[model samples]
Target chain A: MYNILEFTRNRSTSVEQTDDKTLRSYCHLNDTIMEAYVEIAVTIPDLEIISVQGDVLRPHKKEFKESFEFLKRVIGTRIGPGILKIVNGLTEGIRHKQFAFMLEECCHAVILLFTKEDLLSSPRPDDEEESIIYHRQMVLDNIRLYNRCAAFAPGSRIVEGIIPKDKDI
Target chain B: MLKFMRNKIVGIEVKDSNTVLAHGFLDDNIYSIEMNVLIDINHLEIRDIDGRWNRWTTTECKRAIPFLKEAIGLRMEGDFSQTVRKVIGRRACRHFANLLLECCYTAKQASEVLKDKFKEKHDVNNVTSENNSDKNVTPIISADMPDHSDTPFHDKPVSFSMVIDLHMHSFPASPCSSVSVDQLIKEAKRIGLDAICLTDHNYVWDRDTVEDLRQKHGFLILRGNEITTDQGDMLVFGMEKDIKGIISLAELRKEVLESRGIIIAAHPFRGFLTVGIQQIGLTLERAIKRPMFKYVDAIETLNGSVTENENRFTEKVAERLGLPKTGGSDAHEVSRVGVYATGFIDKIKDEKDLVDAIKEGRCLPTVFRKHAGLR
Candidate 1:
């Protein structure tokens, strides 16, 4: 059985170390070890990083409604801005899979975001279960590896599609 | 489900093998953007010392709506049985489009490209199961811009490629190994193979041979080399004409960079080639020591020559390192060229364009053949 675990990180600076993280699954479904990190693949001229603070937290908030809004800006503007964001407000509950910080205890959980789009986009897909190979890989990372949304994970948002819920998928 | 959604106006994002792809919606749907398939041609322009993003030269990418429609239309007919066969058909469509672009280069170059394609596919009327399908021979032609080039694939073009090995030789290849260059060329021409790199083991002989073919065919023949090191084997594109001198992996890396070549760790964990991609060579400690994997451009995630597990492991390592992923057919025979080929979305006029695009990290590699990327 392939374990799908979705996670998120706020920003690069916030990420202390990715090598420290590993995906050790319990089902013995092939030890799929996962590692997460960020990268700066492009140079955005005068690119500004809008901090999500104060009144800047709406859907289209100057800062962003939810923190995931930052990813939308990157759609056509820049391709991969592997930015790192700190995961704060751990108390905030998201709608997708259950999300928490510790990797030792949680399995099959996700770094649930406030949006349905986020929920639809974060789970790892079994081979052939998803249409787009790329979208499947992203979901696979979240399932077997790491984050976005509250944290500035490079894979914070995007890649929305239907996913089979069965483990056999 | 994809075919079900007609005109959904789907969006695509292209990225390098190492660059992590991010999306703002559907947290559950985020996917890894393979570097081999990410070619942004619409806004691509080779930058010079003037720091100006000038067009390549004498070309224009007319909205290829009619041809694109026919290609899709044929696929929509729904009688094709083989995935590989259908892929071949799709490849032809792409070749047709590429030939149209070739018209912008030079008359000689354009003719070479068309002739190469025509010659290869000249007599093979039974490629597909139904002989009638071959009757729909569409000849594509156009005029070149000559004084200038058309706009590229994207505003900030990204490129991705798959290594389609159709008639290549390896170090271990026996004397009777496959040398079906004609077959490979035919497939390339039909599939609209953007660039062909003949990295046959340590020598660049294939490069020269392909070059002649390219000059006659109009396809980009990248000077290629497969460096065999104690660490393992590596495949690179865009190099000097002769790959005779013995160069260490480090030196090879430098040389490839100097010549504007892109290096990819082929089949990282499979066979001896593993010694090349993984910093640690044969040990599991490969990625552990480097901690940064700075020497590699991308990882071979899909090697058509090997098993799915090999591809999976390659992808797993790439994902682990956060490096982008790539694929290749690894075919020494021509019939299997595009099996593991790449699709770069750049308005390239020649070899230099591909090398430049790859070096700039404008590439993506993917397994989903139907996934339409950014327009």
Candidate 2:
């Protein structure tokens, strides 16, 4: 027997400090052969997007000329609350929704980069039990991290007793 | 690589003429749950809810079992799923919330089916008296029942005489902000804010525009800058210089000192708690040693954008440091204008008065949105 359908998607995000005051975040998404990428430069502390650049390498449709230009609308947006709304509002008219997702991913990567050190600073747990307890408390303190990763997936040990806030009805 | 799968099953049965039983089972690689809810079909209200965690990962998972009772009186109506999530999911586990929501949905569907069956039976029996069929039939479910989800949880309005949102941004100045000055002012007035301060990132509202907005709207408008420094963000008041780009905390402190302005740490612990302080070993003692605390005059303990834990951590640091705490919405949009504000004990007539109030510690944090329940 042969499989009827097979599909795979690969997405990557990287953040690098380009200058003393700015950090550049780059995101790429590739579904089969079609690909898209977004690069955003944001100022530190404020995390305001000062510049944006991206392209849809293999357009799903012929109207690829202006598909990536819509990302410019998020140039001044800060990586904070309501960012998803801002990005969605900007790309509402765009044909390729993946571009918007990629842009949002870049912004989130920037945020993760700033806090990477804090995460790294955590003491390494000695055993599986200690690791589970540490991760559980981590998600408890930051509910937003719930179900965001494999370790925090529902039914996982880390999120066993945690109740979801249910931001969306 | 490892493959994992989760299976969830929900079933609804008509237990009696007026009661419906909805049960759900969830089984996965690491956890298993079984739950049953008895609902009154007449009112679509949950009468009883019982659940058991068959296979669980942690002991805390059992804590959610008690919260399941909170759904007993909840009517499966408008915003029913949301209410269930808030009451059960938020307190113990989201999985339980999901299961209860699934049960509620299934029960509602089953009730509708029962109602339809009853209506059909009534129609068959009243074939001779077609008009009388509606006379004796009572509606099992009310149509378009109003839900109190929109009602404010708290009725007490903010009693403060002078409430000012000290941190706000406007478009064109703070490029990141979507709300323009006009929209910000309109929203501030609409929400009954006594005054609003525009603290755009590294940009200050010009005096001319501030005066024009004040005169046009008949509302007090002040200007400040949310200066980005090497250490962290600072809300600087009484400074008129348009210090572009990021500046060092020491430079900002020097400038504020020269100008005799007051600086409030803006969400100082914004991302700290999210990183899991215990794992990182960032204790209160280590947090207080941050360089930004040494320079700021006050702390923003209540910020709209920060999580409650982050705000509490900031409050703790402020208490330990004996620094006065303030509040701000950090609003980039109009609707978020007065979510949090600073209440002045003394009337603040101008920027100077506002600066003096902060310097004198005559202000405290106030929550304007009653639903936040932070007051």
Candidate 3:
């Protein structure tokens, strides 16, 4: 239903080993005659969302600002299962679904960056290592579930953190 | 992505209804920074100046102005941000640096728009003339252009884009500080600070060391000291004589006032923390009403490392007294170098300009949100 007119993603790491790595995403969307650009940056190793700067590029794009600003609710969100929850809640009140999809696209790019960092790889001995691994795996699995259900009916409830009623016992 | 055919001019204007900021490229290389601010009762109009690299206010600008002139002349054949950073580095005019980069990006958008307009009108020769000339004159909005409701959120003109934290503690000087001077400098750069003052508790930075750091980093590092008074802590700048052993508030005031120095009540609202039933520093209610308050230049309205209630109380006290307000991080830790700052309308070159700005009420207290550095 929507076409991506342009898209770019950039990944950069600091010179130090313990420093944060950042991923920046920019996308241009075209639905009919309307067009807009979305820019987002996220830092990993601590999962701090920097900024989401986007604006529609046409005179007819007057009514899209509220939806675009909703994207800013993504700031300070960590890249985990909670990130998707926050993004969904922020975009729920938007009049346009295109902005929501664009936000998801940007968020997903950040999650992929976490995966590229091998967040779910083996862990060495530490006080909280196992707990940290469990949390990361949960986030990865939650993202998988989200991708699986993305094609479902828009308003259908995909209950999170719960077992389905009709599932096999 | 829009590809640049040649050196293009870009404009960035961030404005609210009453306060308007209009600045960008005046020529292909020169930048014009201007602001018309309306904060509370203050109405200040910042004027423009000429000369490419002669008259700069901050130390960073002083060091980088010549380099910028040379660098802008070089053709950009590769990544622009990296090239620019390599030339000027991060410590030089950080806030203005961000503004310049945004202007370059906006120029690309403008170029694309002009290309479309040219295609529609079937006039190729007129495109460059129309776009380039308009930019040369003023990259920002014209007098006749109507107020558009669709300005980009990030592009909105901010009231005081430049902020300098005037109260800070470094590890070597202040025993209470947890962050080293080098770490503090790094964080200040990351937070895009225009300038910073190293004001350790009861300790003055060595003049030679301060000059050495400023030279090495190319950032404005002002010399100041946080004096622990019997009444409270005071941030004093521009003191020509020694103030090391002055304990009485009245005596300190006399010396400071005589030497044309300025003092600000530092975190008076943040009463001394209690440890084993022993409390220190003057309370907010008592500090503002003290006779010493009358002698000080300004009240520190926002202290970054303090609680919200403390800052609120400080703001109320300042407002009630009709005193000019200032802000600082009071940063003992490196992570909070620029969470709060004092915003000055005019560029500050030295301690005297800083003192003058406060005395003339040309400065405003400002607080940035938690993690404002990311934005």
Best by TM-score: 2
Cand. 2: chain B TM-score:
0.57
Q: Is candidate 1 or candidate 2 better by DockQ?
A: 2
DockQ, per model, reads 0.02, 0.05, 0.02
**Which tens-of-lDDT digit does each residue in B1-375 have in candidate 1?**
110000001111222211111111111122211111111112121011000111110011111122233322122122221221223223222222222221111122222333444334434532322222323423222111000002221232345343323224432322223555555566566665565556676666554565687778766655556665323456777776454423345666778788766777766555222111121122334432331146667666665454444455566677777665555656554434555554455655555765665555454554321122210
Q: List the RMSD of every prediction in angstroms.
A: 25.7, 15.4, 26.4
Lowest summed lDDT across 10 adjacent residues in model 3 chain B is found at: B139-148
Candidates in descending TM-score order: 2, 3, 1
Best by the DockQ measure? 2
Q: Which digits, one per residue and each the tens of the lDDT, describe model 3 over residues B34-82?
A: 2111111011122121123322222223333332332332222234444
lDDT of 3 by residue, A73-166 (tens): 6665444333443565556567865566566546544443333233324242232446334433432333222111111111212222433211
Question: Fraction of true contacts reproduced, model 3?
Answer: 0.00
